[model samples]
Target: MVIRYSFDSLQPRPIDLPTEVPLDDEADLSVLDEAKILAAPASRADVERWRDQIERWREEARSRLCYSGAQYDRIESQWAQTCFAVAQVWLWDELLYSFEDHVFTPQKFLADARQRLGGLDAVVLWHAYPVIGLDDRNQWDYYRQIPGLKELIAQFHAAGVRVGVDYNPWDTQTRRGKADVEELAALVADLGADAVFLDTLKTAEPELVEALERAKPGIVLEGESRVLLARIEDHGASWAQFFADSPVPGVLKSHFFERRHMLHHVRRWHRDHSEEIQSAWVNGVGLMMWEVVFGVWVGWNKRDRSTAARMLTLQRSLSHFLLEGQFTPLVECADNADDKLVFGSSWKRGTDTLYALVNRSEIPITLKPIREETGIVQLDLMTGAVAQHLAITIPARGIAAVMTSQGEINPDMIELASEVSAIELSDDARFEHRRVHRVHESSRSKNTGESGVLIEPGEYVLTVRYRGRETGMYDGAPYVDEWKPLVPRLHDPRTLERVTTLDNPVIVAQHEVTNDEFLHFVRESGYQPAVSNRFLLHVKDGVNGRGHEPVCFVSLEDARAYCEWVGGRLPTEDEWQIAGDKQGFQRLEPHVWNWTESEYSDGRSRFAILKGGSDAQYDESEWYFDAGVRPPDFSAKLLLMGLGMSRSERIGFRVAFDRRNK
Candidate 1:
């Protein structure tokens, strides 16, 4: 049997490119709305035909669907049009949550967003998934259990950044809850979420739509990728993930169909975002900034971040033109030659017209926009100043905008120019890399009792094996700069030969610590976690009969505390691997994964390495964390979270004692 990458289903579906065949007037035009990009005809003679055909299709589709677009006109849903830059923030991102303080720091997150991505118009508090199913806690519990999440949302609202909560329809295996629609509606109402991001669904079922609307009138529903044509009426926005564009720059189908329907272009794993930024600018849509993808760091390059900042500044200021103006895709610049790599779009409303341009080449190119009327004030959007000359030079792989208005320019445009004038266009597009470093356990224990197996200190070469999940074993992004990573390269069983040097002798516990052992430690030491939301949650349900079972529902910190109380420390991943290689290292009955002291952080994301697979595994999907018992060399990366959420019923820990000076 051939195992394919598509089996993992990690990547989005292939983009639907435009058809080159000419369409008859009677052709069903509704099918055209499914295209990722409405490509321009290559021949000049067919340009008019291509444009007319699309217009006719839109008219026909609208008539057939009875499209009123009342959703866009709603005063409540109006925010969707202006929400240009939304950050898909991991709930536990370092900037958002302080692990040390055990608190959610919305101010820090907001400040960073403003500085780097030119201020986010909204943020999707991405919870669950890539970490869910570790235990029975459902998706809603992840959000509702947070201590100050409501206050956090309030802070974001105060900063003018709307909050969006994610809805994962795939979470059917976890602890049962109300119907997804009812739970999602209640969650939205409770948190005052401005939008609900359909994680994997292109559109929510009609039942969900109605429920959410009743929960929060004017609530926006944003689908994951391409939303169906008919569903676009209610879906205020859609995520343009992995959308491949045409060479001549094409129009976004959904945006073209309804100008107010926002589509945020995003390629999560790609470091260089020039293509997405350019697409968003030309289409007058939005961009989704997912710096920390799940638990991996796929941060935006400085060049792209600056480009987004500049693009958004103008987009926000002259949004009136972008939203209400008559739009023309691939407008011809006055001095643009056929050979030039620059492309631009023109948005015209009354006497004012705004031109958004992008240079696809590696060198700056100057272009002159057609001056149809005399005495028009040309404001250089890049510099936020008046254009000294008609010829505007766009930096290599950069974006620019020019607002040409009759008489006086709008105060918003002038303010936008002033805001962006201070921003220096960055030429550096280098990927900002962060290496994941293992955090060594600071608290060590002296070797005393020989209750466990003793391993003589020596360097050992171990063959480590793991399933290549998207969360990456220990460090770096699993897929970088790849359009889409498929099977063989994704979610396949992988092997690595690692030579680990252990200078000091140590004794690794033969079996994981039992529930009774941890209970005694907690009772004797009276250890109380600072933010004890889910600490030792199983204890409340009764750990009495499970005294001999491996202790579960304890975080790495909690495990470390227990091990320290026993005058021992949690073994490092290498130490445990070596011990596992030696016979007699037993897994407790009803096996649970052991937490190694291999916590790592790349600043933005923090994760820990787990060894010795557990019996509890959710085998229904590849997106779930690695499961089933395995060899000592097998390892899994668990993204660490604060507020005791890391504590799981499927995970436990053992101890290692360092040999004291003899």
Candidate 2:
């Protein structure tokens, strides 16, 4: 009687399949013994020879079919299939036995295969069972012997090749359930395998997919060909395969081949069915050459030296074809048979589109007019003479690659302004003209004499003067205190909090007027007023000629409105900082205050005020005040005092000219 089976069923069958036969049962036990003997003390020379042979074969195969597109696809499919079959068979047979006793040496096979292949891109080891030896009671003990496997892996990695392992999560000897599969997948990911070979056993494709997602999310998964193909066909898991032929517009058919024969197949297929394949799969074709010939399998003999060589050659040729234009999908097959084929990676740099072209036919072909807005194009891979116009002819089976140019901005043209000068205030005392004027030289002239010199437009360091109390009375009594403090105490908390120290030497009075600053700019310039009708009355108590009193009381619209009047605009925060004072005061002296263009308090307070003081008050303020006290309120004032003066309430002002105006 025939038995019906669902695709999802995981039940074991009554009979063991031929594919599951033990190595000792099928092959001579002596062959296993010989491998064991040879591998027992495998020499460095033995390993090198195998590596050389593999490299030589690969080089030869790649050179032979460098231009064959069809051959490349066919061999790729074959290689993938071979890897899947070998991996599955190995898992079914030899992995359960201990290499120390069974004489199934994976290292010996790898050394031989390496010599045959010339150079391996990578090696993959398939471990079928969780535990290798029957005598090994602890499962972890079986893994301790993996150091030998790791050595081989390290060798390949040092040679610029990657090494991977096949993880069979369903093996009952190692794992008993779904949870075990998950744990094993996580372990494989943690091992950092270059590639993972997954088998479809008791686990379903969906479960495998989920396991991969949860465990090794970023790692490359090399699925069994039959399992992947069947999943795509029956279970609707198209993403299982790297290349699915269904969704791609014109794909006719796809297959897997060994890497050894891929080059030959690609060339022959390109020659014979290039038109059909190109017509059907216009999105370009994908070829898979899994690592079966890398001497990773213990069940099969190492791949023939010739086979390894052929695979390398095929890979090189395919890479060259991809770089050239031959591999591009025929997006729209024109009626003209001479239409050129395009090839390109799906990567983009910027606005420019990149295209790789090749002439498949014997005759030369010229590409149609490419759009100018596509930007100027340059060939990244060109070695010959360069030209603005791409006029060179691509010979038969030759490639041409081109990418658009990226533009850059000139650094030399950007100009930066100099720092703003610090505001320095003159003494509030009377100005006296003297050739060395002295106070009390004429006791009656004291009220009429000045203490400091006058300031000119270029630059000056002015000092404020204050009166000190006399110690005793005499014809002309000498005072105990010489100079009065710069900052005077103010009764209003808001006014006192705004004062700043004179630490910053340089200060600018006014920020270059934004429309806001110029709105109050009653000063005469030759240009007609942008906003002539709007009148600004000079308030009496307000600091006049002090454009630097942190231009305030202006609306946002008014600030912007004034900028047009002065033929200048508001400074950006960066520009304002550059021009304004940055240094903190050491003492309580008010320097000339400057107006900044920045909006403070979220534009609710439309101005930023800056002040500076001397070093004497630095230690004095903390003794009586907390850190939270607002700095002396010179925010709205135009003048700032020096270190020892008592008139801190009188805020000073200074002026700044826009360099842009000059």
Candidate 3:
């Protein structure tokens, strides 16, 4: 549909959004500490000067046998330390999932990503390296020149996901391996990766991280390094390196009894440190993600999947609060309801606060109100339910959420600003929009504050009329809904609900809720937003800052919270179709797989049907649905199923007012 937008499309309108208080002198996009660029070896001239020494170091590493107790020399220059620091800050944004991803052959991983790992943000490639210990320049060259490796990294980058290659930098594996600063630079230079994950390192000398980043500015450094090491300014992430049973609780939750405390020597002090690990997660600390269904899926059951999902979901949902908010330990490990062990922590960013309570046991647990001085509403992330008191109940082996607001909420009393739209998807839909800031091949091209839009993505009011027309294939061109003699239930709802909203068209919000708008609801309603993977991509300072992108991790209930706050509600599935199916309404913007007030079941699991697809950037149709014999297509009748309570980066909602609700 061709729809043009111009200055005269709508009258002047603006919504006053909350302004951010400076965290430091850093205003917009000035969050990075540029003064400490890590001098000397970080510069190309100095690094090139060490080429001969680096080559000899490589030769020595290649001859070392597995368990030879031989150590390969790495660059110890201060410049190298600067690279490590630079890497840690740049890579902190990634949420790692380490598995021997079988689909990651150099040729196919990127192409199959949309189908197998659509929402995946970080990917680690393992299983291809045959040599465990150090080999010389020839072996290193052969490994670095693996065909199609460059293309895979480039594609992943284009999709906004970083790819990391796994290697044990020291001696400890079935066979010992060796790597140094020069070798690290050579590997990254040829592979085109964003990071290198050095396995089993208690401390990844800052020099190595710095050298890698010097070669690739955005290079991330990660591994099963200690928690404190990951916390360094340039250390990207770590794998549960918190001392095992040493005093401080472990943050990396082991998958089973056999594998505890990452490196075999450090036995974990106790089991089920999920609560403690979560504390680290909120602090923007990275964990080794092996107790997951990442690859092979060996010996995995539903319980294992749910357990991993719970941690990932909590991480994804609370990501904004965890990464950006300052972490405050609210409660230490304690015995709670029915003998279940519980712990609590609060991630506070400005007036917005998300309090997380985790229960580790085989039974349910409950917590009474802690801060009863003022009213607070706890929004359960697992169940899309809300309660007024601070008290909350968590499922067995599960986590729960409760957020406190610093503002008042009066949904029924909402007085919205003008320029709203009430239209179905059409060729001529009107809406307000803004493009997110993009880095043009220059890492220093922009500042952190610039990522947070100064202006809000406003609302546009457009009208949508229903069309109850029947469709069929003509000249081999398949229409939205084709009537088949044998299949009677095809294309039924459009004609059914067309008359429902015909009498009085409702006012609809034009754009998907931006991060800034959702924060308003979170701050005012005391509701928690969905912890989404996408938030990690745009969080400026551990908080959601890419305000121009559509808000994700919102549930139907969360959607209702915003609608109620704005004196509106979600559009019905029929109304949504009518808006998109409209003939001549100029479109305000492309779709992002929105949630409608409609649902269905596939004879087993119940799912909320989502409509519309991502913008052209995604290159996939949103209007796709199939049941049994029906095939995937661009049909408006296509319906996609999503777990009602779970969150998705691609799925969200738009607000609308119903005449009937009045």
For residues 1-662, could you state the per-residue lDDT of candidate 3 as single tens digits?
Answer: 85443222112111111111122222331211111111112222333333333233223332331112111112321121111111111110112210112112322433333222222345665422221111111224334533344665676677655566765443222211355667768687777766666655644677786678678775665555243311233443444433322112122221111111111111121123343333333222333332211111111223322333344444444455554576553333233332345545566777656666655565667775245435554444444344555456666655555555555322211211000011111111111121112111111111112111111123323232211112211111112111111112222232121234244435444556777787767677776543332222334553675666677656555676676676666665545655554433222232356766654322211224455654423112111121111111122221111222134444567766543322
lDDT of 2 at 286: 26
* Candidate 1: tens digits of C-alpha lDDT, residues 1-662: 96544532343455644444245666666668678778766755566677788788778888988999988889998998999999998889999998888888889988998898898999999988788867777899889888888999999999899999999888887788888889999999999999999988999999999999999999999998788989999999999877877766777888888889999998888878898899889989999988888888888888898888988887887788898898887777665433677778889999888998888888988777555566777877776666535667788988888888877777777777778878777889888778978666546585454778778877888888988877777667878766666656767788888898877788899999998988888888999877677787778654467899998888888888877777888998888999998888899978888999899988888889899888866768666778788788898888888888888889999999988647
TM-scores for candidates 1 onward, in order: 0.95, 0.28, 0.38
Mind giving the per-residue lDDT tens digits that candidate 2 earns over 495-541? 11111222212223232232224433534433332222212233233
TM-score-based ranking: 1, 3, 2
Q: Please list the residue runs of candidate 1 whose C-alpha ends up more than 4 Å from where it truly belongs after superposition.
A: 1-28, 384-389, 408-412, 487-489, 540-543
Instruction: Give the whole-model CA lDDT for all candidates, comma-separated.
Output: 0.83, 0.28, 0.38
Give the better candidate number (1 or 2) by TM-score. 1
- Determine which window of 10 residues in candidate 1 has minimal summed lDDT: 4-13
- Residue 247, candidate 1: Cα error in Å is 0.9
Q: Estimate the lDDT of model 2.
A: 0.28
